[model samples]
Target: LQKLRSGQDFNSSHQYPQLLPRRHCGKGLIDGEKSTPSATLYEFPWIAKLFNRALGYNCLGTLISHRYILTSENCINFYFIPDLIVLGEYDNFREPDCQLEDPTDCAPPLRLYEVEYVVRNHNDYRYRIDLIRTTENVAFEDHIQPVCLPLTSELKHFRPSQYTIAGWNKNSKNTTGIIQKETIYAASSAECQINEEHLPHNVLLYTTSHENVANRTYSGGPVGAIVPSSERRFVQFALVISPVERCVVALDIVPYIDWIRANMVE
Candidate 1:
C-alpha cells in the first residue's frame, strides 16, 4: 500500500527504457478471438492468458501478485484440467520479440507458467470467483507486471465509468501469443440486466461502442477502472464471466478483497 501510494517499486524495480507502439495484423486461432489493430508496449502489463493443457480453450486473467492469478471461477469449474499461463507476450506468432538492436531493449521473454494451487468461491452460480497460484514466482519485466488490487477505500470510489480489459484472440485457427484488449464502460445494475439475461448483484456490465470488438471467449479477463485521479495506473475492479457482442458481464472484485488478501503471497 505504501509503495503504491508513493509510486515506488514494490516487488521489482519500477523503471524501464522507452518502448515503441506496434500495430497488430493477424487473425485469431478460433472463431471469437481477434488480434488488436494497434497495441502499445507495456500498455497492459498485468494481463495473463490461461490455456487448458488438455483441450484447446483459453481464458484471460489478471496478475495481482507474483504468484497469484485472479480469474473467473466458471473458467475452471467445467473441467479440472491443468492450465498454463502466458505473460508479457504481444505477437502471438513471434517469440522473444527483439524490437531494438540492444538486448537491453525492454521486451519480456515469452513464458508459460504452470498453476500449482486453486481456490474457487462456489457459494452460488453468482460467485464466479477463482484464484490460482503459479508453480513458481513469475519473472517480472517491462511488458509483464502485476496490476494493483486497490484498497477497499479506493474501490469504494469506483463510479460507473469507462474501463479497459484484455483477452486472448480465438478468432483464428492458429495459436499465437497475442493478448488483445478493448475499451468499455461500467454499467449500473439496471443496465447490466438489460444487456445480459440474468446476473446476480455481484456482477456488473461493460458495454462496447459501434466500432467495438467482436466479443469472443474472453472470460476471466481483467476489467479495470483507470484510477480517476491517479497516474497511468489501473486498479482492477472485476473479472469477466461472459463476453457478448455489445456487452461483457464481470464479477465484482471489491467484495472479495479480504479473501484475496488472505491468499496472496508477499
Candidate 2:
C-alpha cells in the first residue's frame, strides 16, 4: 500500500511541471478596440495603498453580482484588510494609480465596499498540513452583492472547454510586476491533471513561485463559465481560486463550487 501510494504520488507529480508560463492572452469585454472600462474590474482600496507603497502585489477575483465579488482564499492574504473598490466601468490604463491619490475623487466609476464575511472550502488543500481554514464569504460593508454558489450536483456537468479565465498577471519572464488584463480558455482537467508543471505535491513544495505563475497577472482572479438565464441574461461564476503547486500559467484549481456551498455558505 505504501509503495502504491508512493507510486501514485510520483505519477501525479510527474504529470505536471513546477511552472507553466501562460501562452495565450484571452479576449474579453475588457480587451480590444472597443473595450470594457477598467472600472468593471474589482479593485481594493487598501491594496491599492499597498501597491502604491511598493509592497508586493497580485490580482485574483471575479464579479459575480453587481454587489458580490468571488476570488481565491489566498488572495485575502495579500491584503491587510477588506476595504476594496470595485471598478465597474473604467477605460483608462493609468486610472488605477491616479485613483490611489484620492480614492474618493477618482472618476473610475468605482464602487467602494467593505468585506463583511469570507467563506472558504474546508477541503482546501492548503489546510492539509496546518488545518488553518478561511471563510469563503467576504460580505461587503455596503450592499455589494453575493455571488450565487453553483450547485454541488452541477459541477460534473461543467465543461472545461466552455470557460474563460481573466487576470492582470505579469507579462514577461524577467519582470516581477505589472497590472494588465488578459484572458485564456479553460483547458481540460485531464490536461491540467496530466501536465507535469502543475502537480499537487509539487505545488505544496513551491508555494511562493506558484503565486507568480500566470502570464498576464492571474493570481487570485476568477475562472468562470457563462450560463444562460431564462430571461436571456447570462450569469458567470464558476470557480474561486485556490493555491496550486506549479507556476505554469498561475492557474490554480478552483475548489469545486459544490464543495464550497456544502462547507462554506450558510
Candidate 3:
C-alpha cells in the first residue's frame, strides 16, 4: 500500500518491503511440495496477464508497484492498448485455485484492473521498456505484491549462474492453463554480442535448455534471480522483450531503474 514518491533517494533494499524471504519466494501451498509445469497457486504473485478484449491479444507482465505493471515494448505493439491486467492468477480455468495435496487449501481469487494508460521508453533501442498504469493503486497482500527492481547500479551488472522465467504457457500445445517456470542459463553479454551482432549492448543474453521454454507468449514476463543477501528476495533483472530463436534477448532492468522510478512517481 506504499506509494513511490519523487526526489527520494533510491535504494533497492528498502523499495519493496513486502517481499518475502528466499524460503517463501516460490513455495506453493504445500509445506514441502514444489509446483513444476504448474506453478503453485500463488508461487509468483507479481505475475500479471495483459489482455485486450477488442484485439483478443494476451501477454505476461510483472507488477512492479502499487499502480504500475512492467512489460515489454512488443506487448504494446498492437493498435490499441490492453484494457485489462489480471493479477494473482494461477489457472485460467479455475476459480480460487487450490493445492493438489489438499484441495481445501486454496488461493484468493484473481485481481483484475483496468489499464489507465501506457508508457514506453522510446529511447531504449537495445531492449525497450514499457509500463502500464492501472486505474487504481493495488492492495498488497499474501497473494498480491510487487517484484523488486534493480535500483542500484551494482544489482544491474551482477550476473548469476541461472535466472528464473515465469509465465502462462498458453501458446504451447503441451502446456495447459497453469503458470510455468523454467531456469534459463545466462550467457555473457560479450559472448551474446559476438553471437548476435544485431543486438545492442544493454541487453542480457540467455540460452535455455529447450528453445520452447520461452517463446512469444512469454513477452513482457519477468527474468529474475534470488538476490544473494540476507534478505534473499527475488529481484527482476530483465523483461522478456524479444523473441527466442537461438538466443533470448531481454531488456536489462539495471539500466532502467531511474526511468522506472520516475514513471512510478509521476
Candidate 4:
C-alpha cells in the first residue's frame, strides 16, 4: 500500500522494491511446441489471469483500475470469491513470481490479489458483465498498468482492421506451456453474422482459421490491435466471448463504453 500511494520510481527505487518492473514476460507458440518471445510482449500489461480457488486459471480479465478487475459475467458468479488474480503473467508453467531476475529462470514477478467482490450486470444475464475488486490497492509498474478504455474518438479513428488474440498452454501432452497468439481479421457486422451464422446479437466477429489450437483457450481472452493509421499501439478492441469453427465472437466495446466508464474505478 505504501508503494502504491508513495509513487516511487518503479524500476530504480529499492525502497519500494515491490514496485519494480518485470524484466521479461513470455514466449509465443506458433503451433503447439515452440518458444518465440516477442520484443513487444509487454505492450498489453493490463491483461490479467483470473484463477479460481478450486480450479486453476479459469479465464482472462482486464485490470482497469487499482481496485477493480473487469471480466465476463459468465466467468464468475456472485456466490464465490475468486482465489487470486495474477497480473502480468505470461507462461502458466513457471511459478508466478514478482522479482525473478532471469526470464529463463522463471516468469516475471507476478502481482497477485485476493478477490473482494463480484459486481454483476443487472440488465442482461448473458452479458457476463462483472467487476472483481481486489482486497487491497494495486501498485502500477511498467509491466503492470491499466489499459485505456476506448473512447468515441479513439475507437472511430484508431480501431484496427486486424488484431491478435493471445492465450496460454501448460507443458506436456495436455499442454505446451507458452502463450499463443493468433491473428484475427476484422469483418463487417453483417459479414461477421454471415460468416459465423450464430454470432449473438450485439456481438462482433473476428476471422479465425478454425484449426489453430490457441483458439481453444481464446474464450474469455483479449483481442488487441496495433492501429497503424492512428499510430496507436496495441489497444484492446474486444474480449473473446465465444469461439466458433470459422469465426470468433466478441462483445462490441462501442455500445458499452458508457457503461464501462461509469462502473470503472475513477
Candidate 5:
C-alpha cells in the first residue's frame, strides 16, 4: 500500500523489462478448469470496465498500453459512450476488492481514468475496432496492467486449440461484478461456413464460440489464447464483437495489430 501510494517503481518495464515475471500477461487462473467460473482476484488484470457519463458500467475493454485502451467500435456507437475507464477492479460493489477464499488477501483500490478521445478504424475497413486514449498514463500494479498483443511474427500466425473469454456476468440476478471466464475452442471451417458469415479475401482470421458465452456480455471483452513455450502467459488475440444466440463472434487482433500500434499515441 505504501509503495503504491508513494508511487514507487513497481517494477516498470525499464526496471524489469519483462513487466516482472510474477505479473506477466495471463498469469492468473489456476490450471485445469473446463467450465465457466468466477475468476480469481488477479486473473485478466488487463480487463477494463467502461463507464458512461451516468457512472454506470456499460461495456468491457482491454488495457493494451499505459495510455491506450482497445475496444470495439460498437462500444462507442450510437447507444453507448464510455467516457471513463476503470482498471484493477474485480468487484464493482467493493473497494480494495479482496479474495473470496482469503479475506486477508486484497487488491489495491481501482484506478479510474477519463477518456481523452477515441479513434475509430477507417470507415472502409470491415473490422470494427476502436482505440481510446486516456488523459493520464495508468500506473501499472499487480492488479492493473496491460495485456500482451500479437505483434510478433509467430503470434501473428499462432492459433490455440482452446481460448479463454473473460468478462463480467450480465445476469440480472447476479450483479456482484465478480469477473467470470469460459473456455471456448476454435470452430472448424465447416462450422464457420455454416453461419454463412463472409469475410474479405484478405481478412481470413476469426473464431466463434461453441456454446453460449455464459450469459456474459463480452462486448469489447478479451478473447485470450495461451502462449506456447511461455510460462503460462496468455496473449490477447481477439476482441468480442457480438454474441449471436449461443454462438459468439470475434474479430482477430492480428488484422488490427499494426493499426493499434500506429494509433497508440495521443
Candidate 6:
C-alpha cells in the first residue's frame, strides 16, 4: 500500500514534459504489456469522442457500465451527444504486436458498444455561474449493461489507500489524443477538507499533473479504489467523478456509496 504524504505541496503551475506519443504509433504490444488505467476520473469504461468538423477535435471517456458512464459532467454539458464508444477490457490503442498466449484472450471478444445517453448529478455544485444545475439521476440505453451500485454499508470498507486509475487523457500540452495511465493513493478526509478551502465547494478532484498544465484534460473520469473481498480478491469502485474546484490534491466528491443506493437503487 502507498503511504499518504501529509503537507505535501503540489504547485498548480509547474509544467511537465509529454510522456507518451500523441497518435497511435502501433508499436506497443497488447500481450505481456500491462494497461496502466488512469486514476478514477479518467478511467471510465467508455471513452467520449467529441468531433466538430469545423473545429476538428475529440475526447475520450471511461465506461461505468453498459448504459451508465461516470465522466465529468462539464465535458458532456459542453459537448453533448458527441460520438461515444465503449471498449471493453481494452488496454492498447494499437493492435497487439504478438500472438496472445493467455487464455483470457480466447475467453470472449470484448464488446465495443455505443453510448445512448448521459446523466449527471443534479446535486453537483457548479461554479462559474449563478444558476445551479440540478444533477441528473441516470442516463442509459436499453442495450448497454449497467454497473451495480455499491451498497451504503460498503462505504466503511473503502479507506484511503493505494489503488489503480486509468484513462486516455493527454500526456502533455504538445500531444493530442493519447491515453496515459497513473496510480494514486486515497487522501484523508481531513486533507481533503483543508484543500477544499482553496476550492469552490467542499469538493476535491484528482489528476496526474501535480501542477496544472495547459491541456491537461481530466474533467469527467473515474476515481475508484481497490478493496479486499471475502474471497481474498480485491474489487474496485469506491468513488465516481463529481465537480470540484481544482486538482490540487487528487480529490473529488465521490458519490457516497450509501447515497447512491438510497436514491438511485430500489
Off by over 4 Å in 1: 1-37, 78-80, 98-106, 173-178, 188-197, 210-215, 228-230
TM-score of each: 0.74, 0.45, 0.81, 0.71, 0.81, 0.50
Ten residues in a row with the worst lDDT in model 5? 1-10
lDDT of 4: 0.58
Which structure is stronger by TM-score: 1 or 3?
3
Model 5 off-target regions past 4 Å? 1-36, 174-176, 188-194, 197-211
Instruction: Give Cα-based local distance difference scores for all models.
Output: 0.63, 0.33, 0.70, 0.58, 0.70, 0.34
Worst 10 residues of 3 by lDDT: 1-10
Distance (Å) between predicted and true CA of 134, model 5?
0.4
Q: What TM-score does candidate 6 get on C-alpha atoms?
A: 0.50
lDDT for each residue of candidate 2 in 54-118, tens digit (9 for 90 to 100): 33335445544323344445555434324443433232244433333345643333343444444
* Tens digits of lDDT, candidate 4, 98-122: 2223444433577889876565555
TM-score-better candidate, 5 vs 6: 5
Task: In angstroms, give how far residue 159 of model 3 lies from its true place.
Answer: 1.7
Better lDDT candidate (2, 6): 6
lDDT of model 4 at position 31: 28
Higher-lDDT candidate of 3 and 4: 3
Tell me how far the alpha carbon of residue 1 in candidate 1 is from the true structure, in angstroms, after superposition.
34
Q: Model 3, residue 200: what's the lDDT?
A: 81
Cα lDDT for residue 76, candidate 2:
52
TM-score of 5: 0.81
Question: Which candidate order results from sorting by lDDT in descending order?
Answer: 3, 5, 1, 4, 6, 2
RMSD of 1: 10.3
